[model samples]
Target: MADKKPEPATKNPKKANLLDHHSIKHILDETVSEIVSSRGYVEDVRLSNVRLLLGTVIIVIALFAQFYKKKFPENRDFLISCIVLYIVFNGLLQLIIYTKEKNAILFTYPPAGSFTSTGLEVSSKLPRFSDIYTLTIASADPKSISANPPVELTKSVTKWFTKDGVLVEGIFWKDVEALVDEYSKEPKKRK
Candidate 1:
């Protein structure tokens, strides 16, 4: 058999290229917000699935009661009692959930990760893999600064160059070295 020519992969026509012009921070913020919001959406879907399954089972049992009436005379009373109980119980649960909607939260899935240390607590809002990019931190060489002693050793200066080529000096107390290290390894992270 002859090998067929590989088809050109179709790109999404509707996908927006608007984000290309935006900064990394803007993209990171949007990604973080989407990830956080999806938690509630996921829980809503889970609860909806459970509600559907229970409703289906209840309907199936009701049909079974009707069809087996002739063969199961002794079980008729039991089935009827079960039907009443099921209706009442399910109805009560629905009423309670519906009425308490304002007071109670619809979903309560636990947070993925949380940490508290001393008086201040910390949480990581790391960006998705696709957002990874090389961020350059250009610090003035100590030797160069020493030769040109206008700037003291203790008060050293650094320049930050973002992936988007926008250069900003004195982006204070920035962890660019650590961020560069993270950017290299983060995309390859398994979990």
Candidate 2:
């Protein structure tokens, strides 16, 4: 029998485009403009910048007042009150501005699933593989897996195989548990 050459492994081998480049400056400019022009509450860069600057200045002044309070101990309460007032005012202003912007944005993009004041709908799609892998890797207990091969190998393989796999409902539950565990270690925030 005549020897025949083996067929090429892949019919269309995907080519890596290492030369693909995008202008960072252009992207940055576009992003900046988009954020600045955004109709959401926190979108107005000019207003936000001004408020932030004023708030910072007020905070510095308040600190200085506290430092000098030893000389005028009688006015300590007044200085403290002023500081509190400035902080409250700044926070309230920011909240109002952000709320307005958020309302505007939400109004522009109405919720597709349900009617809402913000007009935003919660997406029903499952989380991506990267998110799942991250949560899994972060939650992997050292005692659970044998310390033979590195955990990274297992994580990488899991991520690779599950990249396009259908995410079962249990996966979401696992992710939620992982998230809760992760956040439990952090400082509690006021609702």
List clash counts for every candidate, in order.
Answer: 0, 5
Q: What tens-digit string does per-residue lDDT give for candidate 2 at 109-183? A: 321342222221111111233222221112112242221111111122132222333222233333333332342
User: What are the per-residue Cα lDDT tens digits for candidate 1 across 56-144?
Assistant: 76777677777765566678786887788679757855864565332222232322341211110011221343433322211112143
TM-score of 1: 0.29
lDDT of 2 at 46: 49
RMSD of each: 19.8, 19.5
Quote each prediction's TM-score. 0.29, 0.28
Worst 10 residues of 1 by lDDT: 114-123
Q: Where's the lowest-lDDT run of ten residues in candidate 2?
A: 147-156
- In candidate 2, residue 136 scores what lDDT? 16
Pairs clashing in candidate 1? none
